[model samples]
Target: MPKHVWITRGLAAIAVGGLLAATACKPGDGTSGAGGELDGVTLTVAAKWTGTEQKNFEEVLDGFEKDTGATVNYEATGEDTGAYLGPKIEAGEPPDIAALPQPGLVREYAEQGALKPLQGEAATALESNYTGYWRDLGSVDGEAYGVLLKAAHKSIIWYRPSAFDAAGVTPPETWDELVDTTSRTLSNAGITPFAMCGASGWTLTDWFENAYLSHAGPENYDKLADHEIPWTDDTVVQTLTTLSEVWGEDDMMKGGQKGAVQTAFPTCVSEVYGQEEAAMVFEGDFVGSSAAEAGATVGEDAVAFPFPAVGDKAPVVVGGDIAVAMTERKGVQELMAYLASPQAQSTWAGLGGYLSANSGVQPDAYADEFTQDLSATIVEAGENVRYDLSDQVPSRFGATEGRGMWSILQDLLRGSTDPEGAAKALEKAASEA
Candidate 1:
């Protein structure tokens, strides 16, 4: 991510909470302070989770610490965790385990043999709790290396139901219908149909991913993600061209394209719920909490629907934190198994703003009915679910600012790059990366 962008998204998340403070995490099993299974073992774990996320994660880790009488230390990696761990790995010192949202990084470290294969109880826990797509996501070749600890459903669009009612519009089920709703809401309701978060390039990446996944279908989406196909493929251009229906229109977005390119992501969400500056915003399920913070009453004041399919199947693009064991120490293996369990995941899911890919976790683990339904939609998708494509590709290609897909698509929103031009630029960056 760009420095400014990370300062905005990554830093902001970690601001309100400490590391759950490493020292505060260890001591007793309550049963046998010095005699539990992992007694005398000390483990180091790292991830970008902080504030409420950090506190919630701590509840899970605290469970493990209490059950096994092990000493566990937490490290907050802030942004660019790969950068933070690279030198440590080079020095032959790596955390016992690390939680990463990027599957690409898991693949990179596992291929380099820096991460240990998760097997035995850990593998069983993973297999029982998750589906094939998640299994594939956390594996390198045929070996399991990580467990998806939490997930965010990114294939959702947020809007005010009253706004749609005022415009006489319904939740769209197909791409053409979605574009028409955009037009209807603007023409009849006189409100901007979309709150485009162009400044935070990753949001634009999500926009392209949902469209691409639906238009190209999962097989091609996977092929493109793995670089088995070129970005200049016809599907890439077609998806971009399809998106142009909205982007190409001057009045389709609040604040117009130029203004959107300067609007931060939080502002984009707030514009709809807080200021009523726009009628809709599309992104991850996290938008729900952000909207609630802006004083929207969730299912009543704010509503979301799956991003409409361009072809047949609606896309379910997820971004999740994968817990990768950097060492196969006994304590690390035990912790890995525990992290994959329903007992561990449910502890966090109940905290709100958190979702789990673990099927063993019941919907009621979520805080409310709306969240429960959304969580069910994601879990029920099973092997059909797709990991966020940008999250799976190399970061320089997936995440860089003013370069790669981020810049290409940002230019698309600005009307500075046509579909073909965007395709060419994407191919160039993917090849270089």
Candidate 2:
């Protein structure tokens, strides 16, 4: 799962005040020029990554700075996230550049005029460089407010290759087969077939959306995001119902109902590596990195498949980060260009194995066979690669609907709510939103 960092109120106030000051001043602004450009300068960039993730970017940024003679003052947001930066941002002390994990943050800053909109050369360069989903997610009301830095693959179905081979089982082709296979495997091995943890509110919601992507197909999913389809639609109900049955049942999941509510999604990944208690985990491709960080091998020990479809549809999920610029610093623009460059994409994939939005870089070079196969699924998926529904919708609606999902899912698992009741609650939440 991706981590979302938030800005502190003090930072937000500072950011707002700075923007107001910048807006009020003339071409040659208060303390800087209107464009805020300066040659041979350094610009700060804050993000959630530290250690390996930070090194992955810094190594790439080093080349950019060396080539352009621009200095990059990189700040690791660390585990604490953007909470530390919000106050500085609100008070107009934001870094010249920052990468927000969620698109809603981009929308909020862009709508409030806290971000610098990319136009002309930069916008055209971006449009010509990334996928349509990347372009769309970074824009607010049709203007580009951010750039797609990199993407994480979210539609992978990971299984223990050796376990599946020993069980004489093959990946399922459809949703029904998937459910059936899950049950059969569990019954035969006397182990839970699926490893799912719903402790974190959004992690549980991912299961709903991933299942929806396979069942409803990408076109219909997009319709939901656009508010063209009602949440009360049969597809929505069916998807939630299917999820409840699988998640609510005992032995069907690695941990029982009690375990589901307590296990962090990342921790439950352990059930898949040589643990008969849990056999498969549906997660993003980058999950393998977490697995490795937890001392699991990538290619030999684990493998992946696309989340099986309900019928014949392919699956895709939102895979990119929205990075916004706060100032018009010359070095910052140069750094942004390099960050979105093909070289950076290659380095990111090589280091972290996440997909890149850069058109010039391909995943096959460094990605393992499973990663390669996953990329093929993504390409074959094409426009079916629906943007993450939660990120596409207004933030408030996402929060409300997400909480409703958590509450309803917990109730269904505990037998406090029936499928119909859960569906009705979700429908109500969606409708009210």
Q: Which number leads on lDDT?
A: 1
lDDT per residue (tens digit) for residues 1-433 in model 2: 1111111213233323222221221211111211324445777988877777778888877666666656788887754334656776789888888888777778777877778987444565565556676677788898887777767767667776666666666667567777787557654866567777666555566677778887888778888877788777888888878887677677777667777766666777777764545778777776787677656677656666666676456466755566778888665555665565555556666765566545545544345545544544443344677656766665455544346656666666656777777777766766665
Q: Model 1 compared with the native: what TM-score? A: 0.90
TM-score of 2: 0.83
Highest TM-score, which number? 1
- In candidate 2, stretches whose alpha carbon ends up further than 4 angstroms from where it belongs are 1-39, 78-85, 226-228, 394-402, 428-433
Worst 10 residues of 1 by lDDT: 2-11
How far residue 340's Cα lies from its native spot in candidate 2, in Å, is 1.9
Query: How many backbone overlaps does candidate 1 show?
Result: 0
lDDT of all predictions, in order shown? Answer: 0.80, 0.64
